[model samples]
Target: MALWIYRRLPGAGAAPRPVHLAHRIGGAVLLVLSLPIAYHCITAYGVQMDSARVALHSLAGCFFYGAFAAKVLIVRSRHLPGWALPLAGGTLVTLIAILWSSAALWQLAQP
Candidate 1:
């Protein structure tokens, strides 16, 4: 996120090829590392909406992948508007934050 923001800054100039490479590598690593957690969540509890918090977490979890797909598509497309990739990336990040707060933090707060 910080790298994306830095790249977006007005005076930051064009990001070097290595920076873009690093960003892609980081995203791939995050996706690979998240698979086990996603599998556990889906197999263990499925999509429970028994409470508001659970519902938010479940919905965000579901949307995160869709957003990821969109971002990947945006990255690969040649004709998309300039803002499209950033918008997709931002949405994914927001969903991650929501999921972390709604699920992980909630679990940590349990007695």
Candidate 2:
């Protein structure tokens, strides 16, 4: 749906934009906020057994990830500056690493 909207919108399909430094910084902040919540959810896994808490944290993390992806798209569209791409990529990679590590730890802790 979002891809369709972007394609339909004027100027959105033209070219890949670079991400701005500020936008990259914002993405980093979002990634930081999401990491802890994601870690908590992963660490808890089946141990906590609190569906509500897990759901809320997962939703929040999803929102943060969505924002991060949007920033990446904006950067890719050349709307942002070129220098920030590395930062954006680093932030995304770190988020994935943290999520994976936390999940692995959680699994090890279980049973």
Candidate 3:
């Protein structure tokens, strides 16, 4: 996927490309880093969903989505390949999950 993105981009034609092995390893690392945070978000504050908590969660969600957007833009501008489709799909799923969970939490937090 990353390769596809890299191939399609323009400026990325000259950028120092990370080796495939390194890319996979880096992806694994990112997955590892995200797991605990996801677990905590779902298990801990997920149940409460109060306005305050939802506000914070929304902020975090914004950050996550924003970063994804920024990364996509950077890769696109650099004419580099990336795991575009999968990353986009994953981001969509994450957004939906968070929004749904937040709604539930908000209901729970309501008087």
Candidate 4:
């Protein structure tokens, strides 16, 4: 969050790139890290459509991937409007926040 905000400062105009290679690498690492958890959840729960928590996690994971793809696309596409980068980044942040609150926090609260 701070990184994104920092990049938005008035002086940041000199560098038009929204994300560094490191940021993209970190996101790739996170995506890889999530795969095991997702696999375990699917193998264990088997997509419980009747369970909102499970369904939400599943949906959020799906959206996370989509957001990630969009972020990458936005980062690489020069023809997009200036707002596109921030919007893509914000969507990713929102999805991660939702996933954290819904899944990570829920797991922590469990006995």
Report per-prediction Cα RMSD to one decimal: 2.2, 11.6, 10.5, 3.6
lDDT of 4 by residue, 49-106 (tens): 6778777777887788888889888878999998888898888888889888888899
Which segments of model 1 are wrong by more than 4 Å? 1-6
- Tens-place lDDT per residue, model 3, 30-108, is 6568768667776765544357757756565555656556654654464545465557646746765676576666778
Candidate 1 structure quality by residue, lDDT tens digits, 1-111: 445445666677777777777888989999999989999999999999899999999889889999998999988999999888779978998999999999779899999
**Which candidate ranks first by lDDT, i.e. highest?**
1
For all candidates, the clash counts are: 0, 12, 11, 0
The model with the greater lDDT, 1 or 2, is 1
Q: How do all models score by TM-score?
A: 0.86, 0.37, 0.39, 0.73
Q: 106 in model 4: Cα distance from truth in Å?
A: 1.3
Predicted structure 1, TM vs. truth: 0.86
* Candidate 2 Cα deviation (angstroms), residue 31: 17
lDDT by residue (tens digit), candidate 2, 52-94: 5445445445544764776568555866675565566566566
Q: Show where candidate 2 strays beyond 4 Å.
A: 1-60, 109-111
Please name the candidate that would achieve the greatest TM-score relative to the true structure.
Answer: 1
- Top-down TM-score ranking: 1, 4, 3, 2
Cα misplacement distance, residue 28 of candidate 4 (Å): 1.9
The global C-alpha lDDT for each of the candidates, from Candidate 1 onward, is: 0.87, 0.56, 0.60, 0.77
What lDDT does candidate 1 reach at residue 107?
91
Q: Ranking by lDDT, best first?
A: 1, 4, 3, 2
